[model samples]
Target: MAFEQSLRRPVAATIRMIVPAGGAKPAPPVGPALGQYRLNLMTFCKDFNARTQHIKPETPMSVLLTAYKDNTFDFIVKSPSVTWYLKKAAGIQAGSGKPGHETVATLSVKHIYEIAKIKQTDPNCQTMPLESICKSIISTARTMGIKVLKELD
Candidate 1:
């Protein structure tokens, strides 16, 4: 029991935040949240920015950070949200206020497939079938007043 306990580090806190890709700085949300836990702000900002450099700048990336009692931390960065992707693919600035009652834009099955493929790369979604992901995306599109067509006209 003693050996096992030694191997496990007590968790200080679990922090969740949405930060722009490659835009993490030791300021505002990031600084305040991590600073409260006495975690290294500059280290986190540098590592996060490096990891998300491949993604488009200013795209919101969801972060799950685990701060340990020893003032150390680990974080996982997730891709942009489904709504962001949907809006970009539809070339719209925002979803329709009325959703089902009003259609703001249309997307093709191919677009759904592509988005599903991207979402599959997420650690949580890796085990979900591609078809399942596509269906979920379609459902979200419906709620956002986006139409999914068999093919583009």
Candidate 2:
């Protein structure tokens, strides 16, 4: 709590104006530039575990990864995270497998709101109000001349 609130350090900021995409060449990043994006990704990983540590131990382990080109989310697990949520957040449900064969699942996000809502319950997520996070990241990436090939929608 003290770390979250009381600790304060200088957050340097600089403004760089650039034409929007499909216009003139983009401007270079300002401030710490790409560091913020990396930090955010790392933060998301850490926060997810901390917030769910108690429930997660009893819950099964799973690996979550994304396919960048396809804009799809994938998970591989002997036991699914969904089953853990069903048991922990909802009323009791039957445990399907003490140890099941590893399975991988992938899904596309045709509707972004659906994913945003799902993100709320993500154990590894620290980002609430994803809209702003998305905007900042996209803007930063654009300014840095990084391509975003996938659409969340």
Candidate 3:
């Protein structure tokens, strides 16, 4: 079984994107990205929307699509990004232009822990310890000019 699995051809391409749940369309970015792989854009859009229908329509999701040589494809949907959570928690619309030198907003360590817990649910993050995830989130928050505080008021 292992040998047979190894003999199988590698996937032809992988496309990664942050798409809104239930909001895919045959548009420029989606169409061109999938078109290059010779995959049916509509099929992917419909399937993706259907699978994510339970989530809120405007929620942003990370999707990883793997296209096989035989034209079949598979995908995995992940939770929203850490930066998105940070922005929402800090009540900021966007990051500061001068991240290292300027501070845009502040969030609590409680917020960091909550976001880290959420991120741990992602397949790629399942093996990471909560502390590591929180540290990563803290670094990302700093890059976005958001301070992670011991407590928030």
Best by TM-score: 1
lDDT value for candidate 2? 0.34
**Residue pair clashes in candidate 2:** 48-123, 48-124
Instruction: Name every residue pair that clashes in candidate 1.
Output: none
lDDT of 1 by residue, 1-153 (tens): 999999999999999999999999999789999999999999999999999999889999999999999999999998888999999999999999998899999999999999999999988999999999999999999999999999999
Per-residue lDDT of 1-153 in model 3, one digit per residue for the tens?
A: 999997787799988988898888888567887888888888999998998899888789998989888777889999999998899899999999999899999999999999999999999999999999999999999999998889877
Model 2: lDDT of residue 2: 75
| Higher-ranked by lDDT: 2 or 3 | 3
- Count of backbone clashes, every candidate in sequence: 0, 2, 0
In terms of TM-score, how similar is model 3 to the real structure?
0.88
How does each model score on lDDT?
A: 0.95, 0.34, 0.90
Which 10-residue span in candidate 1 carries the lowest summed lDDT? Answer: 76-85
Alpha carbon deviation, residue 97, candidate 3 (Å): 2.2
- Which pairs clash inside model 3? none
* Shift in Å, residue 150, candidate 3: 1.4
Model 1 error, position 147 (Å): 0.4
* Model 2, C-alpha of 87: deviation from truth (Å): 2.3
**Candidate number achieving the greatest lDDT relative to the actual structure:** 1
Off by over 4 Å in 1: none
Residue 103, candidate 1: C-alpha displacement in angstroms: 0.2
